[model samples]
Target: MQGATRTPAYAGRGGSRSIIALAGTLITVFIVNSLIGLFAIQYAGDADVRDQTTLARLSHALDTAREAQVAFKIQVQEWKNVLLRGGDAKDYDRYLASFEEQERRVRDRLEALAAAAGDLGLDAAAMQAALADHATLAARYRDGLALFDRTHPASVAVVDRAVRGIDRPMDEAIDALAEAARARAAAIRADLEAARAERYRTLRTVAIASMLVGIALVGAILVRTSVRRA
Candidate 1:
């Protein structure tokens, strides 16, 4: 009897190779998608960090501005008190000392706000306008103090007039800046949340796709082995 020729299992070999190729393609796609997702998450995180840093600087600036405003108000009140007391020598001297200290504090706060404005990319024109207003007010205060040092009776009246001129506008400007800073902070926080949600969605999609691919690869392996045994 002639020995039968064994046929090469070309079909089975092709099928196995095709399955392997499909699995490799799926894995490559998954890896590429994962890398892209990771890069996006990193970029979002970096943006959020930058925004948070800016917010912190703005907060500090606002605090300094508030303190300066408070100091200015106190100085004005002290001057008023001195005038009420009929400009006694001792009271006038104390008022002068307090006024000088408060003026210095306001200047320091303004400098800090300017630095923070640079960091936050704030409107330069707005900053300039505010600075000009503050400088005018400060100059008036200085002139009043100089007159008071010479025992001029009109010094108290000048200081009171200067305070009245700038107080409301200055307060409004500070409030506006503070409100803008708070709004920006809130926006950044919202952006962070959106980024986090997008990241989670990407991860979930990758997980589901990976699980499906894994199961398909396992099924193909099992089917090929069983056919061979049969």
Candidate 2:
């Protein structure tokens, strides 16, 4: 009789220990799941923030690149006007001044684009080379203008021949740079969209998983209580 009573006590102790161990396991899983959820949320937020900041930067760089192209185009037109109206001293001076001003604008924009490219991890070498080429081209324009026979008709041809096609390389370089910036922007925009979708899915999945884990934990505790009462 004594041994039988002692066996029951031992069995009760084993049952209590089993219940405690199971409860501990559930709590540990819950904590781990909660931590994982927190980590996922943090990761998503950080990625989204980085994407937004990068997109904004890319947009600015693209705008600067486009503006640089426009400025360079206007500069070229002004150069042509200088040759076309070289007979009129006033017009020549005005257009030449405008040409220089536009050149300066182009330089500023290109430099800005280069800096932005560097920040955004794009190829800035082209912008740098373009700047150097633009400087050389400006100097050539001035030198070419020295051959201008303002008193002679068809003297514009002389200036054109001197400066003709010299700008082609620089123009191509600038266009290529602009396209690069545009492509980078497009890629980032796409990544941002994908990341946003992924974040949503992650959040939804985590929420569901956490809810299920919580429900399971509660159910386990209720069953444990009933077992103890029984």
CA lDDT scores, all candidates in order: 0.65, 0.84
For residues 72-155, what per-residue lDDT tens digits would candidate 1 score against the true structure? 667566656656553678776777677667767766766666666666655556656767776777676566555443366666
Please tell me which predicted candidate would have the highest TM-score against the true structure.
Answer: 2
| Error at 209, model 1, angstroms | 3.3
lDDT for each residue of candidate 2 in 1-230, tens digit (9 for 90 to 100): 65564446766786787688777867887787788888887988898788878888888899999998898899999998988886898998899899999999999998898777777877878778888899889899889988998888687888798889988888888899999989988887887798799888977897788778877876887677677757
Off by over 4 Å in 2: 1-47
* Candidate 1 lDDT trough over 10 residues, lowest sum: 141-150
Model 1 regions lying over 4 Å from their true place: 1-55, 149-155, 158-164
Clashing pairs in 1: none
Superposition-based RMSD of candidate 2 using all C-alpha atoms, in angstroms: 5.1
